[model samples]
Target: MTHKILIADDEPNIVISLEYLLQREGYAVLVARDGQEALDTIAREQPALVLLDVMMPHKTGFEVCQAVRADEAL
Candidate 1:
């Protein structure tokens, strides 16, 4: 099965590059422009992995990580 990967970053270049690279390797990629969106996407998509930015709009990467860990369902 194709594993889903989430790229959570506000940088367009990084997101585009990573998406292209991961897609080329046949992995399904999802994107979030900000930390809040990242959290929402994470909950909805349940991606196998997430590439998050340390600093983002709405919330930080560390905050997102903490939320994920704190949530038992996630």
Candidate 2:
């Protein structure tokens, strides 16, 4: 089975590098520009893993993680 990975960051450079690297490694990659986008993507895409940034627009990684942890459906 293919693993879908989500990269949540505000930095364009970091997102680019990580996306390229993960794609080369044969993982399906999805990107979110900020923490709010990350949460939206997570709910929609259901990625297998998430690489979240500690600092981002709309929300922080800690907040996003906490939201996920509190969700019963996830």
Model 2, residue 71: displacement in angstroms?
0.2
- Candidate 2, residue 3: the lDDT equals 97
Top lDDT prediction, candidate number: 1
For residue 72, model 1's alpha carbon misses the true position, in angstroms, by 1.0
lDDT, model 2, position 6: 99
Q: Where is model 2 poorest over a 10-residue stretch in terms of lDDT? A: 65-74
What clash pairs does model 2 have? none
Q: Give the Cα error of residue 37 in candidate 2, in Å.
A: 0.6
- Candidate 1: tens digits of C-alpha lDDT, residues 1-74: 99999999999999999999999999999999999999999999999999999999999999999999999887
lDDT of 2: 0.95
- The residue-by-residue lDDT of candidate 2 on 1-74, one tens digit each, is 88999999999999999999999999999999988999999999999999999999999999999999999775
